[model samples]
Target: MEKLKESISSVLPVTGIVFLLCFTISPVPNDLLMGFVLGAVMLILGMGLFTLGTDLAMTPIGNHVGSAVTKSRSVWMIVLVSLLVGVFITMSEPDLQVLAEQVPGIPNMTLILAVAVGVGFFLVVAMLRMLLRIKLSHLLIAVYLFVFLLARFVPREFLSVAFDSGGVTTGPMTVPFIMALGVGVAAIRSDSNAENDSFGLVALCSAGPIIAVLVLGIVYGDVAGTYVPVAMPQIADSKELWLLFLTAFPKYLKEVALALCPILVFFLLFQVTKLHLPKGELIKICVGLVYTYVGLVLFLTGVNVGFMPVGSFIGQLIGGMSHNWIIIPIGMVIGYFLVAAEPAVHVLNRQVYTITAGSIPQKALSTSLSIGVSISVGLAMLRVLTGLPILYLLVPGYLLAGVLTFFSPPLFTAIAFDSGGVASGPMTATFLLPLAMGTCSGVGGNVVVDAFGVVAMVAMTPLITIQLLGIYHKYRFRPEEVQEEEAASEDEDGGDIITF
Candidate 1:
């Protein structure tokens, strides 16, 4: 019940904001308004169920696989298994699919497969990095350096989408499994470094998609793109609106089913050959899988069917207004409330809190992310207004993030980057991206260059904000260190006096 309440809190603020906008600045037809409300309800239910399901099902599987694979103690086995896990999880990610459909000049499957391989390959690197005790910062620096260098050669049109790919690829479906896998792998080490090493899996995994898409852009040449204007559904009555949602449910059911199959099959294979847990535990896992599938199907259907069109409509309304610049503040406001709505953000925050033994509280993490995402969306809107290049913002932002990593505690740095990836999950992709695209369409901006990087921006800002939180934790806890130093000095002076 508490979880359900929390989920409601996550979804309600965004829904309420939309309602306020509808009644005031961006009113829609009665049927559409009603449909959105219905969607919001479905979203609340879906989020609650999904989060519950993740706790019960998805995370355990990652843990089982991570620990089981590590137990094999063969480098070949660990790398091969981690890579396959990454591929399968990335393949199923709805956010990646959504981003792929938006990108031009590539087959969706081709893009999806490329991004999956990127993630898979990087997941291998991440797992190996932990085992070898490499500095996450060092690896991150080289990879990002390579990413930026590659970006210069990739066409301007592919730039925003390429970066956005990194953010969205690590969505709700991937975060729990990959994150738990990190924890599971890290569990093999009883040393102090285990906790710290557990975090960067999502961070490294996020980078893979960016690099892959950049290469794809260079190779695919002629990746220049145009926006597909959002076509609002025509619904005359409440019954039709309900019918629309009911219809979407089955399609997503099929998608979620197909998506879950690889992971399930892999787990079953492991169960028979390696994991061999008792029957009771198997029954629980099976139950949780069912919950996860149902919840996800419902969530995707509601968000796409209900939220997408409404978001585009609102964006258009705001964009076409005489006070179009208001989109900046409006975007920020939406961003503030919106992060809570992402099912994966809760999962990341909970995992962070648990991993840190509550030193890094979920509330602190959530607040920083809300502020960061607000700024990101505001900047995204600024781009919409100004036609600024995304590269201009990204280079500085990543550099600052890179610099902070040196200053931040290793644990904080990992959590911060992981949070950045988790923050830009399905909500940012489905609602916020469409919102930006619709606004760009209205304002006559190049949607691909301007609006597309909203997810990338969403992904980037948390790197700064959460690291800033780490920096705060540094300062906030400094007095204790100072006191210890003072106490040591006093003891030394007292000893000298006694000797005298």
Candidate 2:
């Protein structure tokens, strides 16, 4: 009941904003409006179920896998398992599928496999970092620096898509599992830094897709991919609307089933071989999996069938206006409220609150993410309006994030990077990306170059704001308390060695 209320609260603001826009400046077609209303309801219900499902099933599965693998004390097994887990989880992410469909010139499977491999490789790197106790800041600096340098060799058209890959890769499907995996891996260590270390797996995993897509760009060499516009559904009556959602159910049901299958098989492998838990617990996890599957199917169906076309139409309508500059402020406002609608966001916020022992309030972190995404959407709109190069914004935004890593507390730095990935979940892909694409179409801009990077911009800004939150957190403490906490962390720095 509490979770349902939270989901309702998260989704209502965005629904209100869309309806308000429809009635006023951007009057959507009646059919589109009707779809949006139905989609919003499904979104709320699906999100509630999904969040509940993750808590019961995904988190426990990740924890079990991480703990069991680490306990084996075999580096080879850990690396191999981590790699496979990353690939399968990423391959199953629905948001990545959404992104792949929008991108032209590349086969969906090719892009999907490429992104999966990248995430798998990076997950290995993240695991190693935990065992080695490497500083998250320094590693992030190097990884991103390498990413940008590689970007120089890729084609301009592919740059935004490549960057956007990073964001979508860490959507609702991946964040909960990955973050819990980090916690499970960190559980072996009894130290102050363990909590801080539990973060940053998502951070590195996010980068993996960027590098992978950029490399794909370089190899493909300026293959021009065009934005494929979504055709609005024609609904003559309420029955058709009902049928529209009803028909989508099978497709998403198949998709969600396939997505969850790999994870389920992986868990069962562990259950039979290692995690011989009580039958009662197994029943609970099975129940949770059912919820996860149903919730995702409903959620994906709503977003893809209902929200997407409406988003594109709204953007097109608004961008075609004489005072098109309004799109910037409007985008900013939508982006602000939209973050709250993301399912993975609630997961991230709750984990951050738990890991930090509630030192960082969920409300504060949520606000920072909102502010960051608001700025990102505004910038994304500016690019659509003026044909600004993505690099003009990305290079500086990342550099600043890199610089801030040095000053912010390590926990904050970790949380900040994780926040970047979490902020740009399904809502960004289904709605905001379409919103940007629609605006670009209306404004006669290069949709591929201008609108494609909205997800990337969404992914980048929270790295700064959350760290700024961290900096604020750093200063909020008294000098003595800060010194004491720092001293305590340092003392446990060399506590033990149990690497696998």
Candidate 3:
């Protein structure tokens, strides 16, 4: 019930915002409006079920598998297990399908396989990083330096897309499983550092797709193509809108089923061989899996049916105007509210709060993500207006994020990088990216360069803004520590410190 309320609250603001625009500034067709209304209803219910189901299913499965693999204590087994787990989860990521379909000229399977291999390789690296107790910061710096070096050589057309792949692969389906796996692995260690180390697995897994796609760009050369626009559905009446969603639902039911099978098979195998838990827990997990499937089908149907077309229409309308500079502020507002609707953001925030004993509030995490996405959308609009190179924005943004990792606390650094992928989940790829593409088309900008990087921009800003929070938290508590110590001298009594 609490999850339901959170889901409603998360989705309502954006719905209201869009309704205000439809009624006042830019009226939409009645069919689209009604479709959106129904979609919002589905989104709320889906989010509620998905979050609850993740708590029940993905969390326990990942924890169980993670600890079991580590307990085996054989290096080859760990590597083989991590690699297979990474590949399987990624192959089924819904957001990756959205991305693959959108990228012109690349065979979907080819791109998907490359990314899977990349994720598999890096999951192994992440597992090793934890076992070896290597610093996450050092690994990130080295890997990203390599990413930039490779970026310089890859074709210009594929550059932003490569970076965007990293963000999309770590969507709602992937994050919960991988993050819980990290926590379970870290649990084997009995030290403070284990908690800090648990976070960067998502961070490293996110990096793998970028490097893989970039390598593909080099081997394939420039497969240049135009931005293929999303055809906004023109429904004649209410029934058509309902049918649109109803039809999409079954397709996703099959897709989500296929997606979950590999993970399910792995779980059942583990249960028989290693876990052997009682019947009650097994029944609970099975029920949760049902909830997960239904919720994802509904959520995907809502977004693809309701949100995507409406977003594109609005972006086209706004950008078609005589004075289109308002797109920046409009885009900023949309970006701010839209990210709240992303399912993965809640997962990341919950984990951060749990790991930090609530020292890092979910409210703070959400705010940082909102501000970061708002800034990103604004920059994306600027790109549409000016046709600036994406590299011009990404290189500096990533460089700053990298430098800040050095200054910020290790936990904050890990959280910051993970937030990058979380911030650009399915919602950003479908609605927000299409919105950018539409606006760019309306404004006569180069859509391929200007619009393609909305996900990349959405991913990048969170890295900087969240790290800034860490910088602030660092200073805010330093003086507080001094003051508390001084006050302790006055009382001559001591207690454990509390700082946020």
- Top model number, TM-score: 2
Off by over 4 Å in 1: 478-500
Model 3, 1-500: lDDT tens per residue?
99899999889988888888788767788888888888888889988999988988988888898898888899998899899989988989989988888888788999999998889899999999988877777899999999999999998888878888998999888899899899889899875467667788888988999999999999999876656788777798778887888888878888789778978998998899998989999999998888888888888888778888888887788788888888899889989988898998888888888878888888988999899999999998888788889889988998999899766666788888988888889888878888887788889887766778889899999999998998788678776674555356325422112223
Tens digit per residue, CA lDDT, model 1, 1-500: 87789989999889888988998988887777777888887888888888888988899998998899998899999999988888988998988887887666678998899899999999999999988878787789899999999999998888898889899988888999999888888899875567668888999999999999889888988664556777688998878888889888777887788788988988998899999999998888888888888788878888888888888888988888889999899899999999999988999888877876776778888999999999999999999888999999999999999999766666677887888889898888889999998898888888877888999999999999988887777657865673454346335431100000
The residue pairs found clashing in candidate 1 are none
RMSD of each candidate relative to the true structure: 5.4, 2.6, 4.2
Could you estimate the TM-score for every candidate?
A: 0.95, 0.97, 0.94
lDDT of all predictions: 0.85, 0.90, 0.85
TM-score of 3: 0.94
* Cα-based RMSD of candidate 3: 4.2
Backbone clashes (count) for model 1: 0
- Find the 10 residues in a row with the least total lDDT in model 1: 491-500
Q: lDDT at 455 for candidate 1?
A: 95
